[model samples]
Target: MAKVSISLDAELVVEVMVLAGVGSPQDAIEAVVRDYIARGHRTEARTELKDEALRELDAKPQEPQG
Candidate 1:
């Protein structure tokens, strides 16, 4: 993967490192970003499934009750 350089506050980096249980700043930030992306993908898939189910339900005809 290509590498890029960016500056961040020391305190914030340390906080991420601790929360991520990573020894290095780079690892901590990368882990957090990867997790964030994975969560977004999962949410999208769930929403799509829900929308499909709703569309299917709307397309079906309802039966009359006596």
Candidate 2:
């Protein structure tokens, strides 16, 4: 674990700690960061899949039926 110090909003940190139900500021911050990363991954995957689907739709030839 790396020890570094940065300033944050005191009120926000307190709110996060209360919401996360964690006693320490470090734990609350870690949880928030982890959630943010996971959400980004999910969003990226969703966008990739959507792009692939659009490309596939454009590539497929439409059949004409009488």
Q: Against the true structure, what is each candidate's TM-score? A: 0.86, 0.81
Off by over 4 Å in 1: 62-66
Q: After superposition, how far is residue 27 of candidate 2 from its true place, in Å?
A: 0.8
Candidate 1 to truth, TM: 0.86
* lDDT: worst 10-residue window of model 1: 57-66
Q: Candidate 2, after superposition: displacement of residue 8 in Å?
A: 0.9
Scored by TM-score, the top model is: 1
Q: Tens digit of lDDT per residue, candidate 2, span 1-66? A: 877788899999999999999999989998998999999999999999999999999999989879
User: lDDT of candidate 2?
Assistant: 0.95
lDDT of 1 by residue, 1-66 (tens): 889999999999999999999999999999999999999999999999999999999999989879
CA-lDDT, candidates in order: 0.98, 0.95
After TM-score superposition, what is the CA distance of residue 51 in candidate 2 from its true location, in Å? 0.8
